[model samples]
Target chain A: MKSMLRTETQSKRRWRYVYAIIPSRKEHDFGQIGLDDENVYTIHYREIAAVVSDSSTKTFEVLDYGITHQQALEKIMKEYCVIPMSFGQSTTEGDIKTFLSRNYPKLRIYFTKLVGKTELGLKVTWKIDTTIKEIASSNIKIRAMKHQIEGKPLEKTYRQRLTLGTKVAEELTKREEKIASEIFARLGRISADAKMNKNLSDEMVLNAAFLVDKTKEQDFDTLVNTLEQEYGEKLLMKYVVAPPYNFVNVRIRS
Target chain B: MALIVDDLLRLPVDLGMKVLQAIADDADAMTLKTERAVREQVLKTQMQFERGDLPEEEYRATMSQLRKRLDEVKGV
Candidate 1:
């Protein structure tokens, strides 16, 4: 009896680490698939349910847990449309039920809009040296500046070199913008919605996410393949189908 | 030292405690802000590593350094 009382007290102290919210009235046991091999399950309140695991700790280091959290969401997405909760969201079971009860209508609308759709990521990069070479040949002003600087001592033509560098950078920005817009326009036509993410590097020309309906997923894939072929050796394209990390993040008030 | 003692004697005990508490709270807030900023940097570093911008050795070194800073801020 004393051990049972200790068990009860420990259970009361454990918080629910939420992964996602799905539209379901039935309870589910996702087995021991959570971080640290915890049992992942669903807690239902009417038609909405929160996918969670009993966690003793409230805070998680993102470096250790971020990928696990995303993988868990992806696993759950296979069977249901997931409204992903941000990492480190831990609260009591009672609070989750109350939250679900209060936000049922809004959550239902998210599911309605998100069903039968997926997010795809596209990143385009180009070799900076090759692009600069192409720019120097085609841009007359840059070509003339380069000709003036060619074979001159570094100290003697410093000012001309600076101007030439500035011109090259300006041309690079213009070219990147043009290419990004064209790519976005092509893919945006087939997507329900699209978002342009910040490019991470100088070589990266485009970083974008598209919310495409399941029906148009194949068409989107074909278009991306076509783009890859068209760009050939000039650009490197990386395409991936991912969870709508950019589109939806459900922030539940604790 | 005598003048400092005189000022402390003039102040009420609860008021002195409140002043200390406010300073502590401000320090706590600053630590929390630094912790959050470090966490964001860690995430950005991870994104760069995943995007192939940062090499493996450099990524690992940066992540370890950031984690140490995070532990320091949190007093872990």
Candidate 2:
């Protein structure tokens, strides 16, 4: 009867959706501020605690619930060094305890690495037409080809057109690389680490995440401002401050 | 009643048809590749569910979105 009752109780247990893991010796209850506004709390094991909330289901809506997850991590980050989990990280309380126990060493390493650290994003895009025009003017062969292909039927000069297109693409890649590397090197100097992300669109030239020290936030901001002025209209820069950089910081499956 | 050899043969029409067939084949290949990608995503999402790393509703929505993208690529 005792064993049967234990099995029954385990089967009836609810799952918790995890938002982030923090190194804490004590348990905390942040209250009903998580996704679905359920009672958010922690499940502590050893020296780490998973900041979580009661979840009705085993999955999460990525975009809609993503905002809630981000908010919870940001809230926790204010008071603790959080290793932010992905948006859909849901698990039972028992599993969370097991996960923490198994990954305690890795978790501790991340906590040490991320102490007083946060992620910042920088995106730079250039006006498409202007960039194309600039490239065409600079490359003599491309300029000549452009003039030669003008008003010609594609069927007749298709090969020449293809070649010109390839050449232009190569030139553009070279230019983008030069610019991207300059920015990467400059930003990498002031940050603990950096990750270059794929551009979302053709116009975007740089999409990077920097794991920066909390103390160097101002320095990073000033550098971005200076670079923006230096690049002027050639590059449109956007800097996102105070967001989790899971791409660089989170070690999946660890 | 007098038709030129080029006009009578109508080579462009045959070439045009061949081009259309090639385009159809290319589109089919693209659709197949996208379908495979969707399948892989579904499997990954299922693993997330088993580990309680993802919610069921979110999985459904994501699968639906992937299906929609596949339909678009297939031009359906």
Candidate 3:
């Protein structure tokens, strides 16, 4: 009864959940530890291969699934140049081949472009109170407006308050743009390519991903450290190292 | 459903049909108005948060509630 139960469990682990594709050299099995630690392996074609594992479950917890997907991609990336799929992307081995065959040109392009490169993410968020104080003290027009309303009661200076508010908004927007561009310029030189994501929250001033050479990774980290130290009080810097390049390379329709 | 439950029980059969028809005609408009209001509210809160009038935790909670309301309206 125990042997039969084990055999049924083994047969249950048949469906493959693909994680990403890398250059084909040999058929390799990365072992269990994929989505739910199902045996991970590869399906090789002519010059490329799909990294996959047994997809035992028909449904998965989205958050947990996402973490496992990223972990799988990271594992593959450690030894090979991989172009990752969007999170939770999975299919059978046959469908994976069809996908590879259909998108061979783009796949080849991705392979060539990402051969020895990895992506890094940087997010910079302004300390709103500190930045507002700095702006109020340094901006001449704002300082003048503040001077006018220095001792006036709120009810009496309503119009001036409104004017100052509008002016502050405009000036803050301009400053954010200027600062974002300045930071991008400073780091963009060391990167092979860079993409800016729309800020996810109000505190965020910059959310950008850079495609960088593996060899230059340390230099990039050092530069980021210096920038963080320089803007220590004014902004918070979050740096992510060698994340999967899905931000730039994950969208292939075919 | 609330409109029907609250008013349908009190009305005579003939009047209830008329009221049901009226509600049926207005249901789409009501939902549209609700979606627009939710959208505007989200934008306002987002602006307040951006301008530093709202704190991050409060803004995040408000945005999450607004998004849930939006999804309910969209029936998603």
Candidate 4:
């Protein structure tokens, strides 16, 4: 939201941000050495990556931390080249290395195909204020409550309002998911990976990752452009492709 | 240790495939350490981490220490 954090150093083993742990399989690590270290049992993964936390404590101290997620996502294009792991990934070193080596040939081929590429993650969200306002304007449920409450006790009337609010929340979830899914579904072929962020909020409607060939970055841009021209207001889309800009290139066109 | 494994340990996508190929390649001497054995070991560590019995930092710390010790033994 603010600005992505960045630094210049001669660090060799670069770490990049993959939005979450789910898509770890997408990059096809194919034995090319992903995690840097493992714990005592030689099973737990402790990567010697550069992904540091954006939390202030890690930001102030770079020598012993990974690069910030904000830094990785913001620079998706130029300097950072990243292969995002789907949310939630962990493994031991020896097994993981063997896994990589086994997949090494295919993964090497994957690297040649996607070496300079970056993934852009874009999500669309809508706040409740507008949706609630729309509901109040069109739905007769509130009007019926107002009419019936004139004769009932205040507590009873308040309980009815609470019920109305619950229904609104439920309907909002269903409607938003439908809209979000339909839009991103159109992008199925263009993406190497896609996922909807269902954890942050029930209202999170759209979450997707688009893998673009370096030369076709503009094609992805045009696809987004078409979406904005149709649904600019009431929808907010934020995105980043890594290794290029550690600063989020946020823009909203009216 | 009495071994315990997590769900990821048995993921059809990752296991079997990595080791099976090496076994087929004829150049590997890892006949004893099959995929299932490695998987059981990885999962045991993971289950410990998940149950809050093991701290991630401590787990990684121990893993690296073993790797280092192994390297020393191999004189590599």
Candidate 5:
């Protein structure tokens, strides 16, 4: 019975859940910060190491553990140029070592490229009513249409009102694109690379991530501040320093 | 009885096996497609929550439902 239990336990083995890879030759422990408060540590191969914690679960609920995974990477990022793995990556220690050995050259290249760089996110949104009003007052065609439809019976001015609404929407989209392009251009010049993410809502004008060198972070901050001041309350901007989630996603299949 | 057995042996077993294999392959492909779609939805939900489009309570409720669906699809 003891032998059978031992074999059963061996069959249901634990694996290392990897969070990120860093360019370090020495092994280090980050301590009980992983999922379920497991001891997070580094598994080393040559000059690269994977920050990981022991896990028996093969699949993780991303909604529950996603924040923990990101937080672990963020903690490591303060000291290391981290190449983040997508959530729920787990494998045996031997497989991890073999993977690091096989992909050392490529991993080194990513490390070199991403060193001293961090990603910053900026989102800009405007009030739809305010923006539509602004557009209507600025565009002569739209303004004329609004005037022609004003104070008319709903049934009588239905088609005219529809046309006016479409015109305003088109102008709103055009204005959004124009502003987005200008903002992207200004930030892109100072960033090593920039990606435009999809806008979540109609009110959103821009959703973008910029990979900026640590040296240029101050300049990026100043530019964002200046842009906010320039737009005032017309545009609401949310900016945050985040991990390079958009830039590098390392996947290892075992 | 021998004749019946002979007739059964002459049936297109290879074609039946091929059909079965194709169905299995299709099922695997469908699972992969569903997994990809669900993952994308999960990401979209996360973004919606982060952008403050959904309140925390609603976000958690929605995420819990999605997590259940994902677990079902994964056979977890």
Candidate 6:
């Protein structure tokens, strides 16, 4: 009796949840859409793949067939690099179609120009110690303070030393910002264009994306290699090119 | 075929549905045993600091412990 009432209310105010489809396939399909035991089709918009979520639960499920979404997103991502919607997005198929239909003129122009390109992301992480060591060598003031604070009681000196730790972290961040600027300038010299995702974290410097012509990937890597060689002592950088979707992670290996 | 609960008895905490159930069902994932626990374990420290119930040093030490435990339970 309760379920029947719930279903009645559901039918009256029906809505679909949204799913962000990260596809492994390089080719985008525009068929009648794939369906499960229930009938629903995914709306593949440019590189931003969207699908309505299941209705019974408020949750929009994500499936990872261990075909890692990263690689899958990249495979399809090469087709037409586009904006990825931020999390918790939902819309009906008909609304999406109307959206696409209305914006077809603008999209066609954007798609045609972006047909033969992919976005490559590069992030440089400095081993914290290396940068700290580098900074410690450069800053005599900090070294003097470090030496002065020794031979004191733990309570008196512990917080004092932590302030130094915070100082070192701040200096390390400034150095990364400097290197990041240099890298972006260098990328502009090599690529058709570049975009930098600048964030101050111990993890990565040079968080940047480049619009590399398909033929220019090797040249881009070769350039990156040269930069890495010159600066590899203090910084370690890795790259992830934007896959077909608006490229955007966490802990468990599982 | 499966064991079903027909009678009410004080049992274990509710593992909230789906992927979370596995961890939540475990005794370890009690995180906060109840809403009261949220207030007692986490918010109380924060409130005490605001209310001048704890010195800054004591508040920080206690808060760090709660943060560490919360991190472990939340897997953040």
Proportion of native contacts found in each model?
A: 0.04, 0.00, 0.00, 0.00, 0.07, 0.00
Q: Report residue A42 deviation for candidate 4 (angstroms).
A: 23
Error of 4 at B15 (Å): 47
Model 1 interface CAPRI class: incorrect
Best by lDDT: 1
RMSD, candidate 3, Å: 14.1
Model 5 spans > 4 angstroms off: A1-12, B1-40, B43-61, B65-76
Q: Model 1 over residues A1-254: C-alpha lDDT tens digits?
A: 99999898778757888989998889999888888778899999888899998887777777787657766777898898788776677888899998998889888888887889987788999866556667766888876866666666768876666676667767878989999999999999999889888896667899998989999999999999999898756688887767676777677754
Candidates 2 and 6 compared by DockQ, better number = 2
Q: Would you list the clashing residue pairs of candidate 2?
A: A58-B54, A58-B55, A59-B54, A59-B55, A59-B56, A60-B55, A90-B52
lDDT against the true structure, per candidate, is: 0.77, 0.70, 0.69, 0.41, 0.76, 0.51
Tens-digit per-residue lDDT, A92-211, candidate 4: 234344544454455445445455555566667775455544544466774454345445554655565455555555666676877787668765456554444432333356765555
Q: Tell me the TM-score that candidate 2 gets on chain A alone.
A: 0.82
Across all models, the iRMS values in order are 24.1, 13.5, 21.0, 19.5, 25.5, 24.2
| Rank order (by lDDT, best first) | 1, 5, 2, 3, 6, 4
Docking class of 3: incorrect
User: What is the interface RMSD, in angstroms, for predicted model 2?
Assistant: 13.5
Candidate 1 - chain A - TM: 0.92
lDDT of 1 by residue, B1-76 (tens): 4343222222232243467689976875575457887888888775554433455578778878777878888889
Clash pairs detected, candidate 6 = A17-A53, A74-A243, A76-A244, A77-A243, A77-A244, A124-A205
> How well does candidate 3 match the true structure in TM-score terms?
0.69
Per residue, candidate 3 scores C-alpha lDDT tens digits across A1-254 of: 99999889866765667777888869887867688777778887778888887765544543235446666767887878887765545555577778878888888887787888878777889876566667676889977877777666767876776677667656767878988888888888998888876786656888887888989988899998898888877899886655455343553222
**DockQ of model 1 vs. true complex:** 0.03
Regions of model 1 farther than 4 Å from truth: A2-13, B1-36, B43-62, B71-76
lDDT of 6 by residue, B3-47 (tens): 121000001111112334565557534746443454356555543
